[model samples]
Structures are given as structure tokens and as C-alpha cells.
Target: MSAAEAEAAAGSEYPAHYKVMLEKLNEQRQLDQFTDITLIVDGHQFRAHKAVLAACSQFFYKFFQDFTQEPLVEIEGVSNTAFSQLMDFTYTATLAVAGEDEAFDVWKAAEYLQMQEAIKALNKKIDEFSSLAARSTSKKRKIAETSNVITETLPTVEGEHVEIQVMGEGAIEVEESGAGGSRRRCKKCSGIVRRLRFSSSR
Candidate 1:
């Protein structure tokens, strides 16, 4: 069999079953009991297991290596949302964000924290979003032509008028006149944020 198949098979073996135990540990970590360290972000305190962080990140390993008596570590540069996502991964080995913008933010925070695994996971999601954007552009053009209508498209990344939308189970639809709008869903948890582009006459 191929190397990928071999790896998958190995993952199905005994040691991989231990992930269930790790997941339970993660649930307890969330409760903030018996936590050895606290990460302070945006003036908010998040309790953490030092051993878990050190095992996952060399940066944390070096930071904790000095082993000073301090129990709280303050982190700056990363927003509270991104830091929380990082902790989510640190605990459950899962990476999730609301949308491309949030994913980028989390990836940058992962870089700052020197968490290679999280960086890789976010990179894969970034690539998926990029591909989706390309497909969307082509699909939009065809739809506009078939409808014989003039369509206007506007792209906004960050702006004052930004609005957030929650979508139902079917395909996502956004009105063109409404500028600076975003829709985010998580499929595994719900539905992940796919880009929402609207078509209308300006």
C-alpha cells in the first residue's frame, strides 16, 4: 500500500485511540481546574495546562524553560478572538475560525506563538478559500450572462460598515446593495465561512 494508506492504517491502531482520552482532558482544561498557567490576552485571563503548551510549541517550551515563579503570562499583538482559537487548538487539536479574515488572524497568531502545526492547518484552509474564490468568480460571471443583467461587484476587507450574517442549510445568498457584509458558518460545528459575493447594478 501507499505511504498515505500506511499512515492511515497506523492512525487506526491503538495509540490513535488515545485521542479520545486527550479530548476528555481538553474538556477539563476548559473548566479551568488544576491549570498550571494562565494566558492573559486583551486583559482577559485564560487558564492553560503548561505541559500541553510546552509539548506543542517550542516557543512555549523555551518560555517555560526558565521556570520562574510567575504563573501568568501576558501576550500582546494577537487579538482575544485569535488567542482563544489558539487555545482551542492547543486543547483539542482542532483549528476553526469564522471566516477567511478570522483564519488569517489566527494563522498570524500561530506564527507569533511558533505553533507549526496550527500554521499548517490554517494554511490548508487558506488554500481552500482561495480556490473557492476563483470558482465563485467564474460562476458569478456565467449566472450574470445567463440572466442578461448588468451586475456590480464590490470587494471590502475591513470597513466601518461591516455586517455579519448567519445562513441556513442551503446555498448562501447575499444582497448586492448591502455593502460590507459577511456570512460565517462552521459545517463540522455547523457550516464554515464561504465567501459571500453579491451581484447587482451599481
Candidate 2:
């Protein structure tokens, strides 16, 4: 696979928690049903949950903490586009910022809002989507440069058969283990493989 494709695939493997958060964010956006506060930016209105905005942005956090009643807020000196992306990032923890200009715009808004999480996420996405050839060291090389490590096991028992799978850096082995287990070894002893078995009594 191409370096860009590999990098994208690696980056897309976000933790399960992030997946859940993203799903909830998208669901909220789709409903657009529980917004308790409105933000007025560049003469446009945006409905959002105060808790979400306060959680993701220190600026909003302090503002909300001090004000007992603020149903509407007016932001100054931020473009509608940048604010939109910032809102999206605050809810989903993902940024769609593309070119340097777009990145800079959203970054400025994030900085103004004191949203550190959004800033870090934007930087990571920017790096991940950059041209693979533009960097001095290839991502593939970086990933491959890690010390030889093999740590994975998949065992399954179905009916009268036992199947085991061992995965390593550059190799994988699938073996069948019945009542009597099976042993597999590499010629160079590059990895450790364990046998799995199922009793015949069942």
C-alpha cells in the first residue's frame, strides 16, 4: 500500500472510546434538538449545548462560570467559517481543516477560544494528511523501525476443532489444534507461538 494510504489507515484506528464520542456528537448534530444556548457570530446564530462548549473551551468555561444567566453570547472578530469548524471540532474532536490557510484560520479561532484539545487534534490531522513525500522520514520507515515485537494471539474452539492464530511484525501463523495440540516454530525463531487445544470429551 502507498505511504499515504498506510498512514491514513493507521491514523483511522482511533480508540473505541473516541468512536463512541464521535457517534454521540454526530447524533446530537443530526437532532439539533437540545441546544440551550445560542452564539451570535458575524451576524449568524449557532445553537449549541453550553456544557459541551464549556467542557471543550476554557474561554467559554470561565465565561459561563461567571455569568449566572447567559442565554445568548456575541463573539467578536471571528469569522463564521472558522467558528463553525471550531464548533464541529468541539463536539466531535475532529477537524476538517484542509490547506494551510484553513488550518491557520481554525487554529486562530481555537487559540482565541483557548481550546487546547481542538488545537492538538487539528495539528495531528494536518500532519496525518500532509504529503507523505514532503517529510524527511517516511511514516512507513518510522513504523517499521520499531524493534522486532510480536504480541498477538487468536484462539477459537468450534465443534471438534481448535484453531489458533499467532500474529507478528511481518508474519502470521494459523494452526489447527484438536484434542492433541500443534506446535509451530519459525526457522529463525523470530517469534514465540503457543499451541491451543480443546478437550475431546465435549
The candidate maximizing TM-score is 1
Top lDDT hit: 1
Q: Which ten residues in a row have the lowest lDDT in candidate 2?
A: 149-158
| lDDT tens readout by residue for model 2, 30-113 | 467677675656545567888888888987787678653645555655777899899887777667776656776677677667
Candidate 2: how many backbone clashes?
0
Per-prediction TM-score to the true structure, in the order listed: 0.62, 0.53
lDDT of each: 0.64, 0.61
Error of 2 at 1 (Å): 47
Tens digit per residue, CA lDDT, model 1, 1-202: 9999999878765776678877877877977767877665654556788888887777778767855445655565567789889888887888778677788888877776678898889888877776777677768979777544343322322322212233333432221212565333322212322221212222
Model 1 RMSD in Å is 16.3
lDDT of 2 at 22: 66
Residue 173 of candidate 2: its Cα lDDT?
A: 28
Q: In candidate 2, how many Å is residue 78 off?
A: 0.8
